[model samples]
Target chain A: MHAIKTLSLSILLGCFSLPALAEDPADADPWEGFNRAVFSFNDTLDRYALKPAAKSYKAITPDIIETGVSNFFGNLSDVGSMLNNVLQLKGGAAGQDFGRIMFNSTVGLGGIIDVATPMGLPEHNEDFGQTLGYWGMETGPYLVLPLLGPSNIRDGLGLIPDSMVDPVAEVDPIRTRNQLYGLRIIDTRAGLLAAEELLTGDRYTAMRDAYLQRREFLVNDGKVASFDQDQF
Target chain B: MKKSIIALAVAGALTAPMVAQADATLYGSLRIKAQKLEGTSHDNLNVTDNSSRIGIKGSSELFNGATAFFQFEQAVSTDTGAWNGGRLGNLGVKGDFGTAIFGRIWTPYYSFTGAPTDILDNATSASSTYVINAHRASDVIAYVSPDMGGLTLAAAVLPTDKGAADDETLDIKHVAANYAMGGFTAGVSYLGFPAADVDVMSAALSYTAGDFYVATRYENRDAGVNGPTEEDAYEVAGSYTMGNTTLLANFINDDDNVDDVISVEVQQKLGKQARAFAAIIDSNVADGGDGFEVGYRVDF
Candidate 1:
């Protein structure tokens, strides 16, 4: 019994003394303090303002109308996606995006319905950020934009060029354009309501890490270092 | 018409950029198994659901680096097409200090001790002696300390509502400590049923080296004022992975019950979120029998 006790003590001590895994990369978030403050501000605004508004919008809208609104915005975004795919030299993806725009706009009643997907013309979410990443630009420091949430130096810069070609931004008459932007924002947030349950751990950290990992996944077209789908 | 419209809406949401939002995450696993059992009078082939479940979890920053979180999980019966089994529902807060959750929860005793050797996706848990303790329970309040070096401590209490039993407010209590470093982990746990004056002690050790993993557990239950005096159980399990394929084996013995179980399995990974597996199990009890099973699991 004494010898058994001694063995157990030794094993316990060994377990405690074993080395730990390496720490997270320090350079990933050089501006963590500022970024955290911005994240908090954005989170507060989302909780108090945007989320409630989106919830109300979803509550009032019919499912068909909601889907139509989302599809319309999606159809418009395909134009920019096609441009970005061409810029990144992905001919197949560019063609598919072009096909989606034409099919959805014509047969689908000005994009109010999405006939392209059922017709095997899948949506490709190409953007200027992904184009830059495909051309070998490194994602710099993580940043949390006010009200916009997680981003990085490269993607943030890419967003400027992306906005220039945004169909909503190009809409004539300031009032109509602003209304379209507001509707799009509410629809997007409402669409995310069902997905919110996937978040885990620290809200800020989970969002940041997911954003970074997803960006890498997109830029490499799903060729990620690790693909553990069981992780939540 | 409504269903088609809803389906389209779902498709649109699924194609959206998934990682930009700060909200709860929804995830699930679906597993179904086909099996054949032998050495039993009514031995037959059966298709069964294997603990498939879906869950939603979220956390919100509270104050001073602390955050509040909640999770709700429910089992889905794939074979029967039913979805009414509740697995977990808990709310908690955590920070540098620790985590405290109250609701239905997996017992610390099971997590620290039984989990090491409860590796088989199915059949093994029911055939093994680790069924001595309740794996999960409602009305549980659990606490887990933040990691100190490689050591972590956890505790839980199950309280009975007034007038529910013989006035024992504290129905069951559990305490556990675990140490994890690199690829090695060790744990010890103690559980007590105050009303019955029964107690259990268990220990587990596990190691992972690259593609190989092994674990062992020992448990002793003192069934005071209950039955069978004392029961002791032990189990050992091991697994090896090569590329997308993994092989696993486990053996369990209950000294008091004179029961023994042996199980082996081979699993093949399909992409990132899906797997197919085949298993064989044999147990030496009156109704216990040999069985073969094939299953598929996918998670999202």
Candidate 2:
């Protein structure tokens, strides 16, 4: 306990002594003109087609069922997250992901109920893109895919491998796989409805900054040096 | 043909905003805590939701120089998968003449006095320290005057229910005013419950300089039959922020009922909208032992 107290004091002192190292946001969008066009295309599609479907899905689905669907997909994503953690050489996080998968698959009744989080195995969002970033690959230029919305060159390429490992894509029957993919899309979109309020100023800029910041936060494991602390 | 198509798409993209409808922003924070509370007789571990909420708010131009706004916020329970609805559901108009809002909303009294020490993520702060006035009340018509030379005033009335059997209409009224100068702020608030013959008066003073902040509040409750009669409460809290980490401590003494409570917390910011914290609370009241909590919060 004494040693722990001393270590805590040292960390507190170090925190107070550290200097602020703020960095300008490196948006690095050379293809803004083209990206904006594609963003608009995706936005229009989302507003007309996908958004209404997601809204309807949210309206019709019971809360417990919706949560179960989300949890099922989330549990599946952990397989990829675990793989990425291994690739990034993060043994601890990889172990936690493995534990989450095992526990949730069985005790959680195929992840319909997320029993892992309550057990202290927190969720993580990891992919090949973050693995490449951990290995010092640059983000490259920002790009807005035709239907994928915001991404970068590195992440766009990472998507291919990610898709290959995606459990839903591995479903034996093509029809079932396609249906699962559709449900996942709608569920993901519906989950984001509550977050739509954070958008402010230019929609494009806000979306771009938020996406980039979120990517960076995930890549760095939430240790962000350039964060404006006073914004809160 | 591809070049022409690209040019046309760009044109459409640039002009899309002109045809867009007014959008309401949806935002929320999700906070969950795992805690261990040890009392004189029992100890338990539990997972608790700490005021997780989602809200949609928007404003529309009503006329020249006048705008109308509305918000509907609801509480969510992540632990139990239940929703406690209608934390704040209000509609108002804002312009040079000041703002008037009606419906269920935060009371001006609590905003002025209780909010100073309400920094912690759990119930150990405002809920435990200050219990004189309701944090948010329903059926309230509130008006806040525009800032005039660093001073702002607000008042609210909860109209009586004449048709109801209880006839408690116009029973509650609240008034508050705050002043700010440089790094220092001071505020006072009053809540009156005429039918119950109860009244609460509170004052708060706070100062912030760079990463350091300190605040104190004092409250007095007049004689009342329904609750604690002629009670007084005092609270003081301070916090220091260092980069992404903050250290906070607070103490409260309620002259009646709750006794003395003290809490300390450390919070680390994960990003602009996410934080993790660990806190401990110790209460002097009988069987009101010690509680420790660790939690993470994400706001979107």
Candidate 3:
């Protein structure tokens, strides 16, 4: 019975990814030129501005304080994660995610400390882009937004509706909200500092391929059949 | 070519029903753990992503009665949304005689050194202290012989870094063999890094009957290229399952470390693809050194 429920849930969730299922998406980049151009722009901005700012932030901020800032943002994202889990009909996971928010908020000292994980309630990551892909929607075309970097037509469009559900969208005073948004972006980039060294080859192509692969992984909820093989 | 095509057509017609059902698959597990450690050297509480990983794999029958397979698995951190790294990214072909593969995959020695006893999900686990995890190799080729009466042999070779700017050496090799009969199984692996001082040899033995199972592992690292340092470790572990619950315990002894741990874990099935677990570890080297964690694994 439990197996049946899990299978049905996967099937329902799998519906969104069926359109492009057999299409052999090994070379899914149709907008390569435009994407590369935008990617260059994003890269320039990162090299000139964002990366430096992040470095400065890293140098000035103490490690514990930086972790707290990350935890705060993480706690905020849990609201969106809970909503997506509920939408996917994962009631148990949704409940746990909700518990994460409550515990991290109160006992964790307003999300500065993560007190929920040791309690056996784990974090569930979800987003509107993944939700759309869960509904059997085609990933559409590859895209690179001006500042957001790698994305796709479906996920790029998802940002609009997702904002409607974001708690930060409801914050008063546009300046304060903008400042929070800036901090979130910087914090996220800072977290990726070590991983940047792993990137190899053409920056545009590398980022594009990684984004597509990651999106597919998310859409399938980390279940995908191997389609390519290498031999000695 | 025409004759081969005809034969393939005949074979395809014969297996069309099964062929139609063949498909690739993607699967992974997400595990997040919250842990508290109290020791003379450390006292803190934190949440961690405990080896959360995602992977895709599949195999297809070829016309020549061989199967071609591939898999790509990578680690993802749930707490901080980081890409930890890649694992088991390889492709291979299998047939009646044996199987051959290339690309990054688990070293044959890993099964002997870590697979049996590294049951707990985090650094507090015995593996951190007991296992020397040279568990993966890149740009290598490997082969596994067909099982003969419950016995199998495997070997892998990593080539030299000729393209590297440095005068790096190569010819690293790993070999392993395992035999299983009835309620008992045993395996040993030798990893030779002739150019470097990090050669490791390990072995594991296990037995299971009914709902109870136990295993032991040992590993020795030779001193050479890096420094005049040699290290060795041993571990013993056991587990029992009752209904949907499992109880586990493991102890590690290391020659180089001043701290060692003995841990006990309780894991409960939450669903077909989910589990909740709690573990506690006691330290033998430090005064007031102990660690506790509760965690969950959600597989999809």
Candidate 4:
């Protein structure tokens, strides 16, 4: 309950900074101060509580079970991605994601196994944030949310609408839903454990820039954008 | 479509037997360049096939937790449409005990000294002219230790027979060790021809982060014969990738009458499998030699 209150408070604070993000500067980060504070809070929480839990999860879970859990979550994400592809009007990608979902859900035994990839139905990663960007939304100031983590204005807004389309969000039995959500978070964090060794420089800024760059790349779909003439 | 079908048929026929035995992969690269060389005496222009090669490599699991692998690579002259001589041929067995291989292979010394800094497509890289023992040797046997915490040691020997009346002698010996950690690598290599009275030693270090990669190499050579000729060479190279283009540059100083060379190259990626590149090489020797080349390369 306390964690939920903190999460809601962070969202409220993040929303208050959106206006400043709109009117402020041309740089990628306009809410550096507030974002830094949130980043510190998130980092402290990760270092103390979340990291330990993820470590324990990794140590206790067998490899095959962990892989099955990851595959199940991945199938769930693909379902959301197919909807996002429709919203973005990417017909070809939507067809591919649709094919993936069909094959994986059936042959893969409720997404516990991944037999589709070897059959050459490659994964397509689409999200509501990418959909917003495809519709000509400029990624606003980099913001760090409390429990949700790094995001921008458009992507943060995207979460609200996108969550409604997610089947997991509609699950009955509040305890089960909460447990699933918690497991997802823990699984994701545990997956990133090996990557922590590569961190260098200022952790907060490095992570922020990497996140923003990756988001930009995904939004552009591996294409370089021409320079905006007005910037000259 | 007809030509592609014939080509595919030919390739399939050639690889059919290998495929049945192991996981054979038919891979090749086609690199053709239009080159111009300028010297103090004359200028020249020619189209050259820059180490274009096709190879088949495969590996299969052996009994007792070991794996057996073999590779046969042959150079092809794209300009003349002719198959050149073999580039590499070797068979090996690898397991936790490490790898043991025999036949034509690159000496560990060549890989340790040259691999890090030679980023260009063709002859422009200073290593071609500056480094003496950069070429591969035939009749070779090599052993490589399994990686121990990112550190690996390798040793190779090239044995040659002088004539029918004489026994085989190990003419060349090479030993190298490399350590790699998080996009950073450091290596040292030594090459010795005891019968020929020549020795070469080199050390190299490289680091890669984000869009930039940089490397430096230092080498010393002692040709004990011919009035005790001794020389040293130093090279520094770097490359930066920005979007679809990668810019590369290298400088080498061979300590023989202050001879030096500098090369710059730019490669633009056409797609996933093809790239077009241009390079210029300038040498500061007294004779004044330089070259310019434009090339396109495709890998399959």
lDDT (Cα, tens digit) per residue for candidate 1, span A6-89 = 122222233222111112535678898999998899778878988899899999999999999989988998998899999998
- Residue-level lDDT of model 1, residues B1-300, one tens digit each, is 699999999999999876654379999999988776775652776778988999999988886879999889999999877895899999999998899989987777777777877766757753443355367778899999999999999999888421226677688788999999999899998887787777888899999998789999988878662255787778899887655556678988876444687887766566699876667778765653687666778999
Report the lDDT tens digits of candidate 2 across residue range B187-287.
99988776766778889999999988999999887866226467788889988775555667888887764568888776657679987676777875565
Candidate achieving higher TM-score, 1 or 2: 2
Two-chain DockQ for each candidate model? 0.01, 0.02, 0.02, 0.01
Task: Give one digit per residue, the lDDT tens place, for model 3 in A139-195.
Answer: 788777877667778887777766777777677899888888888777777766655
State TM-scores per candidate.
0.51, 0.53, 0.50, 0.51
| lDDT values, one for every candidate | 0.75, 0.76, 0.72, 0.73
- TM-score, cand. 3: 0.50
Interface RMSD of each: 17.6, 11.1, 8.9, 16.7
lDDT of 3 by residue, B1-300 (tens): 699999999999997776364467989999988777786544667777988999999999999999999989999998889888987799999999798989988766775546777676545454542334357667879998898999989988877422324334555767899888999888898877655535777788888988788988887778752236787778888877655556678888866456766887766676789887766678655443576666779999
Candidate 3: fraction of native contacts reproduced: 0.00
CAPRI class of candidate 1: incorrect
Could you give the DockQ of candidate 3? 0.02
List pairs with backbone clashes in candidate 4.
none
Q: Which pairs of residues collide in candidate 1?
A: A196-B24, A196-B25, A197-B24, A197-B25, A197-B26, A198-B24, A198-B25, A198-B26, A199-B24, A199-B25
At residue A176, what lDDT does model 4 achieve? 87
The candidate 2 chain B region of ten consecutive residues with least summed lDDT is B160-169
Best by lDDT: 2
